[model samples]
Target: MKAAIATSYGSPDVIHLAEVPMPTPKPTEILVRIHASAVNAADWRLRSANPWFVRLVFGPFKPRRPILGVVFAGEVVGTGVAATKYKKGDKLFGWTSLMKLGGHAEYVALPETGAFAPIPAAMSYTDAAAIPFGFGTAFSFLRKAQVAQGQRVLIYGASGAVGSAAVQLAKTMGAQVTGVCSTRNTELVRSLGADHVLDYTKDDILAKRDLYDVVFETVGKLPFKESLALVKQSGTIITGSEMPTQMLARLFAGKADKQVKVIGGTALSTAADMKHLAQLSAEQAILPVIDQVLPLERIVEAHARAESGRKVGNVVVEMG
Candidate 1:
């Protein structure tokens, strides 16, 4: 098996392609021959040790897991004795738990009961590879906020992966959606079912008097004060990307106002959520937005592209 090995925590240049031993399924696991995978924030964040605290969880000097990838779209090639959920030839897509990241390889073994779901018949591997991170994160946060029909919802970074999914899912839940993005992505956000699109460069979001029932900050760029001001009394603010300082401040925000609720944490990726996302994609209710596709050999380039902050959506890598 071939795999992209992350030698250490540093630049994308640290990742290199090498031949590795194929993975065999454990008693409750299935062996999957990967067809495609995605390069997401998780990949680059772990690779670069961005937050500095990442070193505490991953490693002090180097990464614990050298092959870094979380999202995978592949076919089951074999199953262990206790793995009954899937069989040979079954096409599946989902997240490999952060603790056991190995989606960049040509093959990987995962628990059958993990966040795995069948790929929709109408969807391609590349598209399936793109959904788990963005859509799954958005779905988790939206459900956490308990967004209901007729509620006013605001999403920042509407052109990015999680932001794009948030716009579509919020509309599906019947919320009045307002999306904020760059000028070039205003139309793109509108097409994704956002009721109103605001270009961050031109629009003064803080100046707007209308208060929202929920405000979702996907990029971590929105200030806590601004988020608190945007939400109506007794409303919710969900931050998908929270800096350490923001996380600390949110603890006292609810105490200070006693009217607004602040929510921040890692997104959950469950099998049930993956199944729902697959169904939505099959129905064309939520579409996967891919910025570019590269071969597995060019994973370094893929990492660079994902970290460049210019990609509108996912960067998929095909395993040939």
Candidate 2:
């Protein structure tokens, strides 16, 4: 088996491919031969340990897991005796959790029941692999917001992975969706069901006061004050990106504005959420917006592309 591994975090150049031992499943696990996987901002973030705090969770000197990938679309090649949920040749897609990430490899072993579902018949392996992080995160935030019909929802960075998915999900919930992106992506965002498109370069989103019932800051840079001003009274702001200062502020702001709530963190993904995303894909309601596809050998390039922050949606890496 060939895998891209990182010993110490720094730049994308630190990741290199080498032959590694094939993984075998434990009694409660299944061995999946990966077909396609995705490179996300999280992948690069963890790889480089961008924020100094990540060093505490992963490692101070090196990464806890050498191979870094979160989403995988693959076929079950072998299963342990205790694994009853799936058998050989079952095609599935899902995300590997923080501690168990090894999706960058040609094969990975996951518990019989982790975050995965049968790929939708209408979707390809590349597309299914793209779902977990983007759609899962977006779905989680929207659910947290308790989005409802007729609610005006504003999505920042509406052309990226999570942002694109949020645009579609918000529309599915019958919200009047407004997407913020670069001028180049205005039409693309509109096609994803955003009722309005704001080019960040041209429009000043903060200037639009009290306009939305829910403001989703998918890009993570939206300031707390601007977000507070953008939302209607009692509205909620959900951020999926890392903003430690804002997170800490929200934690001790009981005496602060009680009318607005700011939330941030990675979503808790479940097999059920993957299944629901599959159903939406089967129905053509939400589609994976793939920016580029590369072979596993090109992982360094893939990581560079994802880190560039210009990809329309996801950058996929095919394994086999």
Candidate 3:
């Protein structure tokens, strides 16, 4: 099996393609022949081991997992005796947990009970593989915010992977969605169901007088404090990165009035959430906005593109 492995954390050049042993499934796992995978910001973040603090998990000097990919869309080629939910040739899409990152290979073995879900008839492998990180993150945050119909929701970086998904999900939940992006993506965000589009590059989102019931900062730019004024009383702010000190202060201050809440972290995805997303796709209620698709051999280049943090949506890596 050929895989792109990282022996140490640095530039995308550190990742190189090489022949590696194919993985086998354990009694509770399944061996998937990967067809496609998507690169999340987490992939590059882990590769470079940025922020210094994350080195505790990735490594102080190098990555713990040599092959770095989390989301995958593949077919079950073999399954362990204990795996009953799927059999040979079952097409699925999902992600492994934090400790089991090996989706960059031609094949990977993961627990059958992980976030895996059957790919919808309407979804292609490329699109299915793109779901876990972006869609899963959006679902988790919206669920946390308890989004409801008619609520005013603001989404920063509405053209990025998670931001794009958040716009669609917020619309599905009947929120009046305001998406912040660049002028180039205003139409794209509108097509994704954002009720309003603001170009953060030209306009001042903080200057907007309308307050939001929920503020979702998907790009990790604009500190929590800067967005505080936009949140309505008793409203909440959700970010896709770790909660910093300023966010903590708002979290505590809001407790007395419960007017504001700051939340952040990777989402805990479930098969049920993936299934729901599949249904939405089949119904054409939600469309996966893929920015580009690259062959697995070009993974290093894909990492570079993802690192720019300017992509309009998910960038997929086709494996098979």
Candidate 4:
């Protein structure tokens, strides 16, 4: 099997194409012939081994997992003895940050019980690959904050994968969505159903006195204290990345001060979320935006593209 293997953790240069042994399924797992896989911020974060703490997981010297991808849309080539939900030849899309994060390979073994669902009738494998990380993360965070209709919600970095998903999900939840991105992305964000779009470069996020019921920071670039103030009394502030100390203090302070929530770990992948996203995709209620698609051999370039933070949505690596 061919794979994008991380020989060492550093620049994207460390990632290279390699001929590797094919992975076999465990008793409760399935061997997937990967059609496509998508990259996430976690991919580059793990590659760079940044923030120092994460290096503990990736290993101080090299990546703990040599293959570096988590979201895949593939066909089940074979299944383990205990696998039941899917049979050989089932086309599926799911996440595998749980089972060693090896989706980058041409073949990967994932637990059948993990976050996966049959690919929708009308969806392509590339689009399905985009769903697991972007849709999954946004779905988890919005559900946690209990986003509701008619509430004013703000999303930072609204053009990126998670932010784009958040925008549409907030709209589905009935919130009046406000998306914050650069001027170049204002229209893109607005198209995702944001009621209002703010170009963070020219517009002041905190200048407006209209408090948001929920503020989602996907970029992790906002100052926690300053950004939290944009929320209305008892409103929530959610972030994909870590929140600073003052924000944690407010979060621990309980619902009295708008119940700030700093989310890090993802929600358990549920069958329901995958089905709902698939249905939405089929109905054209939501669209999976693709930033780039690279061949399996150019994974190093794909990682570099994802690390740039300039990608509008998801980047897919297609297996030839």
Best by TM-score: 1
Runs off by more than 4 Å, candidate 1: 251-255
lDDT comparison, 2 vs 4, better candidate? 2
Ranking by TM-score: 1, 2, 3, 4
Report the poorest 10 consecutive residues by lDDT, candidate 4: 243-252
- lDDT of each residue in 1-320, candidate 3, tens digit only: 98889999898999999999998899989999999998888888888887666689877878878999988999999998898989999999888666788988899999988887889886889989888788888998999999999999999889999999999999999999999999999999999989999998899888864389998989878666666777887788887764356456655453444457767776788888888887887888888889899999899899999999888789899986
Q: Work out the TM-score per prediction.
A: 0.97, 0.96, 0.95, 0.93
Scored against the true structure, residue 150 in model 2 reaches a CA lDDT of 99
lDDT of each: 0.92, 0.89, 0.86, 0.83
* Ten residues in sequence with the least summed lDDT for candidate 1: 249-258
Model 4, 1-320: lDDT tens digits are 88888868788889888889988899999999999998778788888876666667678888878898988999999999988889988999978764389989899998887778888888889889988888888888999889987999899889898999999989988999999999999989998899999898999778854388888888777766655678787677786766345446545544445555555544556767787787777788788878999888888888889989899989999998
Segments in model 3 whose C-alpha atoms lie over 4 Å from true places: 243-258
Query: Over the stretch 6-116, how does candidate 1's per-residue lDDT look in tens digits?
Result: 979999999999999998899999999999999999999999998889999999999999988998999999999999999999999999888899999999999999997
Query: Model 4 TM-score?
Result: 0.93
Clashes of 2: 0
Tell me the deviation in Å of residue 16 in model 2: 0.7
How do all the candidates rank in terms of lDDT, highest first? 1, 2, 3, 4
**Candidate 1 local Cα displacement, residue 79, angstroms:** 0.4
lDDT score for residue 224 of model 2: 63
Give the number of colliding residue pairs in candidate 4.
2
Can you tell me which runs of candidate 4 are displaced by over 4 Å? Answer: 243-268
